[model samples]
Target: MIKIDDYAYTSGLKDVHPVEKVSFALIFLLFTIISKNIWVACFTFTVMSIGVLFKAKIPFIAYLKLLFVPFVFLMTSLVAILFSIAPIYQEDLEVLWMAEIGLWQIYISSYSIQQSYELATTILASVSCLYFLVLSTPLNQFIWVFKKVKLPAVFVELMGITYRFIFVLLEKMNEIYIAQSSRLGYQNYRSWFSSVAQLIVSLFVKSMSSAKELQIAIDSRGGDEHLYDVDLSMGYNRGHFVIIFFSFITLFMIYIMTKS
Candidate 1:
């Protein structure tokens, strides 16, 4: 628990509110949609990297590794799109393969390459921003920030309970699996499947009981009125809004200037 708390609260992004982090992320997405220009995307990425260091105190290399997993699809898509949209060579312009719509024909122009490169970079940069945001912030803080944004109370409460219980269920499952494995209960494939099936059914029953108990506990403590008693503050400030607003403006200008 201590280790988990340390990882959660002191991971270099504790000071940034979840809403601001999400807002910065949305700006990245907007940039991606507006321009496929490589230079603009690179500029946005560089700015975002510097901002991460200043605002979140995250080491660039550490966060880069965390982002690698989410970027795989982006990288693959960029490569495929770049190859598909790239212009044909002057000599190869007339060289057509068997008739397939849009596949064999090439435009053979400088603009094609520029457009494809721009699009690829925009996607990659946007994906990187989202990945960094998630790694830097804690899950609980996300829900807290959502409450202030006027998210439905029932939805928030349900999400919170689900998030809290998922870890609990994982812990219980791990204990059961370890004990069974130690006793050679999973020596055969069939036995392992059966054991897992039984474990899931058992977990479901326990979760249902736990939910009932939680409902009872809440009812005993004043139920629907509980949200009125809880303090939810919309903690926006000028600095936060200004930073986001300017970032959006700059990115929008870049998009307009470079877009095909």
Candidate 2:
């Protein structure tokens, strides 16, 4: 039988300790906040790429494909904001110099460069780091780590429930959609809209019914009073520390190199 959560479904980042994974992600966020140098951003990307490669063992092609998701949003936003601003004061800006092309003449005001580079670098780094972090960490482990970090328990619990509920809702919705389509539900625009609305309403009702049944089942099985318990003795292994440490070291080196 084919497993639902197979290699395609799960990221290898789940192997690392949750706390370590989150820590590295936060550090990347911090770097983005403090730096705007293109070289620095490039360096950070290199480090993050390495982290995704070695830490998660994700294929290079997979990483590029995943990276494209954020790149589209980021580049679109960057170009939109940058082009919108008019050059109030024309000054020769030193953009990437092409060999034998002495200082390509481009007029940029003070505010534009400061705004564009800072926004561009921070957004790219943030998106890239977050994508890797999410791919590596399981939703449950991420929540558990957040709790360990002393984040608000209520918020975390709510987020956890919402995350799980989304997939459940999607599964149900997909099933309903397939059944409806098989019955020729989309005969026209009016029919399509009405059918979709009805389908959603049915899904909500079914979900509520499931929730009630689940509650009854839990009560029947002892109602959270030792219904089930797991004994976990998680250890901090060498590989975990090694990967996290190297990520930081590489990040720091990138910062240093870019500064020089």
Best by TM-score: 2
lDDT (tens digit, per residue) of candidate 2 on 93-145: 44332122233333334555567877777777777777667667666666667
Clashes of each: 3, 0
* Model 1 worst lDDT run, 10 consecutive residues: 90-99
Alpha carbon lDDT at 115, candidate 2: 77
Global CA lDDT computed for model 2 = 0.66
Q: Would you estimate the TM-scores of all the predictions?
A: 0.66, 0.69
Runs in model 2 with CA error above 4 Å? 1-10, 59-62, 85-114, 187-191, 207-232, 238-253, 256-260
Candidate 2 backbone clash number: 0
> Candidate 1's residue-wise lDDT over 102-146, tens digit each?
434333234445656766677667866765566556666767767
